[model samples]
Target: MIRNLLVAALLAGSATVADAAQWNFSYVASVGTISGQIDGTLQGDANTIFVSSLSGLQFNGTPGPALPFLASASSVVGGIPGPPALSLDGSANNILACSTDTVSSGCTSDGFAFVPAGFFAPPPVFFSGPAYGGAFFESYNAANWSITPAAIPEPSSWTMLIAGFGLVGAVVRRRQVVTRAA
Candidate 1:
């Protein structure tokens, strides 16, 4: 019985580890002399990025995207209304970061934007402007961002737990039968 319990405990612990969620994130940006944190999440497929929250964010001493723009979505290159070419470091890289053209249509560059695969590319910079279009652009080395994996269990984790319990029960029952025969 003690052996069975040990096995069950080991199985349960392993299940928790398997269910962990890895999230890569970074929120560092600076315009001129001011910089702040940008909060967001990257989808599992690496196709979409969502800016769920923002705080202490600014550009050249001006408040960045308003609160209403926080929950916006940005898609990959093949996505609809992809982003524009981004300027990182000193050279311009052709990566569709975000679209600042429309705000009401849900494709504004204020919040959502796409990053390259592996989430290693720099985040785009968005400046508040008119809904039609104005001074908005993407820069590679403008912001400080990081990707971190969150510890959240997936459905498979539950399955592992159940299977572990069943194994423990089976081992216990067999042990009891052997003891009775003796």
Candidate 2:
């Protein structure tokens, strides 16, 4: 039992804490500054869905099919309008190190990271920061950039959780039958 408990604890810790480290930046056009909140969920969770690295994070309008969820990888949040080549300037390459999760301080050129058309789910653009840095995104309103504290749960987590509990129940039933026979 002790061994099992230890194993469980270790697995839990690894799932939630292993990847916890530095942060990166994302550009939310609405906020206009870097903050911590890629879309609505937190990318900080290692187990969750969050881009592990970000180099030059910027997107204008990229048109794709309509998807309800968001993307921690795609620089183009699906179903936007047009990722019209960013309006670059001399400042395009001047990326700030570990800057805002949204709105790069040096992104004065491509100030508009993601300009939405109607309503896209996860903002409509994602950028990765060096694992040592942080990963974040701008809010829908364009207030400031925010960090995605952890990874968000995809559809799989929920399905797995339910199945795990069912397994536990089956084990308990088998033990009960054995005890009654003895």
Candidate 3:
């Protein structure tokens, strides 16, 4: 019984160490504001996806690290007015506040983590819906974060080590119980 409990604990710890989140985004215009975004759902719902980074050349042609935030007024194409909402293909995150500093050297890449004030990345939505009659969810980023697809073994190793110790304890317990019975 003790041995089984030990093995279960080890396995649980290993599983957590083997997970990573991938962040992605899509660029859209002709239906966004320069301030807020309102991504509406098309078929009624959206699928959840992980996020990590944003890629592709931006509107201004500054190739490095495109818009970090999804469909911000400044991130949209053609530039819309302030407090605009970028419609989506599913249930949206319904943001209340959003802002980013200038992407120039020191200030650039400052804070990418979506934190308080209604900033966050919703799960991945399909590339459906049409903005300019094309792939509505235009350009964004899809960062795949895995356990290096290799370090995944580290967790298993830890589990084995712990389980080995537990086995030893179980053996010692059994011996004690047997001696007491005799």
Best by TM-score: 1
By lDDT, is 1 or 3 better? 1
- lDDT digits (tens) for residues 1-182 of candidate 3: 66665665565445333332222233333332111112222222333222222334222232333334443223222233232232233222221111244422212232121111222223332121121122233232223111111123455767666776776667678878978999
Count of backbone clashes, every candidate in sequence: 16, 43, 24
- Model 3 misplaced regions, further than 4 Å: 1-22, 27-63, 66-182
On residues 28-89, what C-alpha lDDT tens digit does candidate 2 reach at each position?
44323333322221233322322233333333222211122222221333332221221111
Score residue 152 of candidate 1 by CA lDDT.
Answer: 68
lDDT, model 2, position 127: 30
Against the hidden reference, what TM-scores do the models get?
Answer: 0.39, 0.28, 0.22
lDDT scores in order? 0.44, 0.33, 0.32
Q: What is the C-alpha lDDT profile of model 1 across 1-182, one tens digit per residue?
A: 78778988788667764322333333333333223343444445443333444345454556555433422223333343433322222122222222344544544454433333333335534333332124344343433443344566767788888888888888888998999999
TM-score of 2: 0.28
CA deviation > 4 Å runs, candidate 2: 1-34, 40-149
RMSD in angstroms between candidate 3 and the native structure over all alpha carbons: 13.0
